[model samples]
Target: MTAGLLPAPEDRSADQGVRVSRSHHAARKVEVTSPKGTRTWSASALTDHGLPSAARRAYEGAAEAMAATDPSCQLPWTLLAGVGRVESDHGRYGGSVLGENGVSHPLIIGVALNGAGPVAAIRDTDNGRLDRDTVWDRAVGPMQFIPSTWAGAARDGDGDGVESPNDIDDAALAAAAYLCSGSGSVLSESAMSAAIYRYNASDEYVALVMAMEEGYRTGVFIMPVSVTAEPSPDRAGNKGRPGRGHQNDGRKPGSGATSSTKPHGTPGGKPNQDDPSGPPPSGGGGNDDGGTPTPEPKPPKKPPKKPPAPATEKKVGTLAPCGATWCLDGWTLDLGGEATLAKAAAHDYNHNEVAGETNQQELDGLSGAKVSVVVSFGTATVLEIEGLPYP
Candidate 1:
């Protein structure tokens, strides 16, 4: 039973749309690439996030710590995975990778926070130590921890004792600790959302993360797509950010994870006590401390996994319309899972906003073009779209 999305939006909850309960499969020793480096994970669920083994392992550790720290909180691994995906694409940013030692060789640093516009403004907390700015601090590592917050919350996640921010294992622990600090339980949807809002300073950001997390958890990636009159040159990748039906919106993704609005030394960001959407108006998703150029270091490792053999790539949909042709603009749709073009979203990212048909009547002609599709074991919801020009 497939159905299109409602134009007005119903629950406004992130858990809407296709849901994949869980995968019951044996663990495979697969290696994946991240900003830190290629590492192996013994767990099957962790690898489904399209993340390298190292990142998944770090996230597993983080979720474990959070659960242990607060049994009532029971934080899920996908929340942190969502954060990692949004913040730095599983630490694969800047062409870096997680080393076997847990260090993000070459380092993962964000732009300087100049206090102008959306970026937060905080002076240097550490003098040329963690981020090496000595002036203003930059969010560091896979989880993007600000120096000010990292100073007090940084833990030896790998048990190496040095408490290095470059280590993904260590960073995961610190991030989990911060998420659980506000005395809030991430168990409930509302409470979990509130916790995510504290991490970044925007409601949109939280939604994007939660959406991605759901996909990772269920192994069903949702790719939101739009059909346009004119050709879109920016097809291979998004203009500013990554993923579907979402954009940066001039606000940093995780700026408020540990903003100044909260009492100093606390891991939690400026919690939106009132909105559960983002940081305080004056704070939250602002810039980092300041701007200073930091040259990243590269390392030798097996590059990220390549697409599987063409023979392995599966395709859905009947050629029944006989010669119907389809054009796709987003990332390559991986047809490795039990997927099919099942329903039309009735809307997608249009004019930079979610635009769609209001009723079935409005979508009259689209039925002929609608092709139920799905891709298993990959990321993306709305990938390949088939249509015919107006008659």
Candidate 2:
């Protein structure tokens, strides 16, 4: 496993119920090899599968490439689909669309790896090249490869000549290579767990990915019904996805406490010092030291209030001329026009956040390009606009 490639776990507690869901799936196995040992799959399998078309293709292509190059690895496309589903929901996360070329538009960049809460801190390695932030490195693309790891393991799976983390084909291939770097076939449950654990050192993440992989391998993949669905009692506090942070109060998966500042509690162990959970601590809080004391059950505490919504948000989409000023949907940029947009911050064609008058002059030409703009107080301002045909 690479040092800085440990991305934050994602929030997928809602889908934990698949373990006990309806088991009848017609028992169909996805084909992965032909008589010649080359990878192959039916078009109906790809079309009817839950994964998006581009993402499925990328996963299968990566598996095929790995099968030909490293025959001993035995990489399956379903494992990649499981990772992609948990990582970025097959590149449909945050309303981002996966292009025909396996590139996710607006880019599925994970939260900053600034060591905040349960997240691992990784200082800027690519200088805001892959992820837009220079202060901290983030997981990029459908497979969510960190900048440093992507720099080392990037591969041009789509034959695009350029190796980009934003491209799902490259990211999936890179992920397959990383998984196969170690010995053992990932088709086996134990080997698959070990391989996934290397990807993100969390047991819950491995379990979730395995569950998803099993479902995909069979035809009974049960996705989350809704975002509001709660985690099962067994998975309770261990709510997280593949390549992002936990949705719990900044807690790592399987940990009993809200924060990792203190000792983490295990099953039947002492409660954490930060947030005491499970049973009462030893002899205190109703469990008397002596006698069969009749301890009254305490009422459940009220759930914590959710944080207020942010006043401003970054809106990502295509931008076009709305009368005089540039607009995306109903929102219009406060800039006078392409000429007045010079002062706003922007990123060059390579997605690198640039500065100075030279970069500012290039902003005038982005009339109909895809962009990310900060919308606040009913006024939209360009933050980091993608330049030209998109990298």
Candidate 3:
């Protein structure tokens, strides 16, 4: 749904009104922008809390690496932990465990995304190499990365000489990088919501993840004296600091997968079983460490202002292919670049009839046909088709 459309029904465990309570000591509030308005987030000091030994190390290591490479991102370990908890319970989903080497013991895989039911239909991109399904794709590992996305964002977090999505170290780093993409930093509330939305493409999912993340930040736990210490000389020297010098762990896992169907690392349909209705036990919901005392997060710098957008314009284009859920929901026009037909226009088209057929039916049949579009803010509510079955 766009800005003004009725909100999609909340998913299991993802109430549209979900909010993380902030009673815990040392909590800090950060405003987050969502489709439902502004929501406050409480972030707190670093704590080992309830995280597993290997998993905690990987989370911290990934944050530290990102800090070194992209300091502006201010990527938090807690954020990565939130995704892990929601996606696969920190590699413990389905009785699987994060082994000493940081790889999932039994491997956590989701159902095939065959475009069946509420699931998005995505043709197999990896040919049974990563998800073990040649016909369709499935979310895999603690972070649940899809094969195509993993191919681009995969990292060697543990410096183990191989990059596998099943490894928490690699998965966590890849997820951090994925969330940190685009122009703005994730520290801002709007940017944070945008980043998470890019991950799952659902407002409910964003609220749920933020709530769980806030839980970890404020929950009672042993606070580390220093959460942002400079990388230790030993750690800085070895890219495998978290791996404990284990280069060849002998774990050669397949490429990872995602539960959802959107391309470019969007995992839409994966069920978050960590806490169906609430936050997990403290640190379990989030994990990342800082060696120095955790300092207060600085406010994000505002971007330079821009002029207001123009009212409207007309362009010629063909319809974009209906591959993902977003495409199926609205009309996508390919006028050199993909643009969506406004929801209001879509509703009108669906109701009108053309040659005894509903406009939606006709529009679907006319996919890829040339047409002229009247657009504003990259969305159009008016169209002039070159060819139509009816006048």
Using lDDT, give the best candidate's number: 2
lDDT of 1 at 85: 64
Residue by residue across 170-205, what tens digits does model 2's lDDT show? 889888876675454777656676676556543334
TM-score of each: 0.47, 0.49, 0.47
Please write out the lDDT profile of model 1 over residues 1-391, one tens digit for every residue.
Answer: 0001101112212333334322222222112211111222222322233466777788898788666645555778877777776565566665666676766667877655544334466678888577778776677877778777666556778776577667888877766765664444676655555666555544434444665676667766432111001113453334343222121212234321211121211112222211112111332333466544343333333322221212111122212221122222112333222222223344431112334433222223333332323222222333322321111
Candidates 2 and 3 compared by TM-score, better number: 2
Provide the lDDT at 350 for model 2.
30
Q: What is the Å distance of residue 309 in model 2 from its true position?
A: 40
Q: Model 1: what TM-score?
A: 0.47
Ten residues in sequence with the least summed lDDT for candidate 1: 1-10
Q: lDDT of each model, Cα atoms only?
A: 0.46, 0.53, 0.49
On the 0 to 100 scale, the lDDT of residue 314 in model 3 is 35
Q: Pick the candidate with the highest TM-score.
A: 2
Candidate 3 stretches with Cα past 4 Å from truth are 1-49, 220-391
lDDT of 2 at 99: 91
